[model samples]
Target: MPGSGRLVDVVDTTTRDGNQSLWGATGLTANEILAIAPTMEQVGFHALDFTSSTHMSVSVRFHREDPWELIRLMRAAMPRTLLNFITTGMRFIAWQPCDEEVMRLAFRCVVRNGIRRFQFAEPANDPSALRRVARMAREEGVEEIVVGLTYSISPVHTHAYYAERVAALADCPDIDRFYLKDPGGLLTTDAVRELGPHFAATGRTVELHSHCTIGLAPLAYMEGLKVGFDVLHTAVGPAGNGTSQPTAESTLRNLAAEGYEHDLDPEALGRVSTYFRELVREKRLPPGEPREYDAAYYHHQLPGGMVTTTQRMLEEIRRPELFDAVLAEVVRVRAEMGYPILVTPVSQLVAYQATRNVIDSERWLNVSDETVRYFLGHYGDFAAPPDPDVADRVLSLPKVGKLREAEPIGLEGVRARFGRRISDEELLLRLTMPEEQVDAMRAEPAIAERSVPVDAGDRAPLVRLLREIERRRQISYLRVQKGDDLVVWRRAS
Candidate 1:
């Protein structure tokens, strides 16, 4: 079969995996999560793959969670579309005993509330326990249960061990498919070409979850499709974490060009991806790109510190000093952490990079050492600085600068009050400075280069303008046409 003919299901991970941990950033709001759902469905993806219950609830503001609860909100929001969610009792780091009963209840609640597709993984490497969880899910009428094998950050096991787990799935009636979920994006392509077909032929159906952690997921996904794989997961926006998900739209675009037919259309899917990318830039999110821009992506991260938490450890060297040594350390830290040095969450990436870059360069090593210690002490506490606001903007945005968290508020409500006439990026900056100061910043109009500080006046408007430019670029994806005023999703022309 040509590549397109073989591609079938596309599972989206924007909400679950994308939001909870953004690249070089932190978790997204429930509304932020909800905001993307309809677009995801619009992309013709087979499922939404909502995030783990453990990840989502903790990240959401507590109060705004009631009506239109994220899950319920998304379900209701995309009523006609097919979507599924996965909740894990399994901790990625190591196996810990969790109340299987609690896990079951969470599953039941999510399923009853609208989540149809569910995944069950072992807390540790206990494949045996997962079978039991699968059995429970089967009892609950979940037709498709995904069991994870070789997920990143899970107990690292050999291919042989993974084969053994694949064998173990035969015991669970609920398990319709098994996944090789490399969340840390650690899978090697050679392993994929060899193992992907191997798993597909294992007399068991399989799903493949790969990432661009070391930068090979897109090719790996292609290899999976070529080698006989089924559903593959991806994110529609640049807001996705670790490795980007392979979108149905992009893959379908390739398929259409190659004369392949799919259950869904590429043009329709493109419309959604466009909407999603807009959300990223509109919110000052790190932009997602194809292979060429990976290094630039890290260099261009919004808040710089999140990208350089390790570099901060290196002795600050003048330009003449060779950066080879510093770069080497970054690679080492990345390998040790099993993830990239730069992950992108919406607000956090810019804030982190901004903080890191502007931080006194003279104190780089001192800060690096402290950040390294913190990273080591708290490996996955990626969401450490929940929110931080500048001193002057505190009262106006009670929810802005929280280092931890506050009762969650409605992102929809906030946007509604502010007027969507301003983009997410503009809203963030608008909250940061006074109107008069904003105009002054817009007036002087020095571009944001190398993180220089502006007088409150120049600073506010400049921030607004930068974000406005970004939002404009993302919106350009839906280019206007001759007859129609708006660019929209339509059947292939």
Candidate 2:
């Protein structure tokens, strides 16, 4: 990730945040993690974000066996890869870190385990929480601390506010590096541009943890580079798709095109992309695309190019037509507020770059001169510079204001809508919600029923696919109502 004498360290999170949404459907094994380790190294990523020991029971067990042992093994396996970890935190990492002593235990996991670096996704709105976490990291002698912006949760907040919160942490004697964590999968390059100066002001170096939820990670990262981020978080292609982050391939390619000397090998990136794609494809998974290529991919494959979350929504919701309505409502709200309601920055870029391809897109694009300049900084010379077109077309894109503001749903409703078999992660992602939302999603029958069904062409494909999924045993059949139609024995598996 070293580019132009500026050592831009890259963190490859393909198996971690990059696969958060996919974890429900597919949990990579130790071998799977190991297999991709080389791919990461091949791609010239400075390091692999490794795994979150705090995520699940299996991962915890893996951590307990001596992280050093595992790191040593991975190190031996992919000697070139930098293995890192995010020990424990507020979210899925529900480790028994009941007290401050637990913090020491987490720290030991890093140093004793050959884990050179570590991070915790510090939500921007929660400065107190971030400071506490940062203080602990510093106390533990942790080499580097990446402060995650966790951008998606508080989209309503401004760039200045986030910078202020992160900047405050910069002075914390215990920390080394800072970062922006765009966990909600909603980050944009332009947003990064607006953010870089604030982080740079901190005097401490800053890093960025972006996502490809709406696919602008590469661009966001590039913007961060223009503003000068010391490190950039990324992943291999395709696996770095929706719910993932900007891919190493695209980021490197962008840097390369700009005539930067990336210390990591570009050929290695290509190899890793191929390696990752084959595995994902074999896993019966979808391919991840770089935001840089999303416009091309979106133009070439709109129906398939849609994010997994949106596709899941299509499958779980009742009113097939409601998607359009939901998007329209989103557009109406965004237009009313004066911007395109893009899920992320790249989604806006793709919309601006490929108008006819995005779904009912034209109405939501509210691109402005400022946005086009940002695009130019990231995408380089456009045969047709998107700046003016972006400004002209920004309002033309569609929005999802209604869906974004949707209230918590219920469980019996969950049983009816997505079926009782829906994994907690899938349910949360599809609903654009949290685990607690599941409790609500199960309570109301109508709310659940209001969702789209996980439809297959017929019972045969459905049954076979269900059986293939390990969760088939967890599902329960139920009834659902859609307009004048009601169906019984409706299965979620």
TM-score of 1: 0.57
Model 2 lowest lDDT segment of ten: 296-305
Task: Score every model by TM-score.
Answer: 0.57, 0.56
Task: List candidate 1 segments past 4 Å from native.
Answer: 21-27, 33-36, 61-68, 80-82, 90-97, 123-125, 151-156, 202-204, 240-242, 256-260, 291-493
Candidate 1's residue-wise lDDT over 27-125, tens digit each? 445555554455455556667766554443333222223211456666876775545655444221111222444345445655666767776644233
Candidate 1 worst ten-residue window by lDDT: 89-98
**Each candidate structure's count of clashing pairs:** 29, 44
Expressed as tens digits, the lDDT of each residue in 145-206 for candidate 2 is 76665453122456766766776676767666677666544556677778888888777777
Q: Which candidate has the top score in TM-score?
A: 1
Give the per-residue Cα lDDT of candidate 2 at 213. Answer: 50
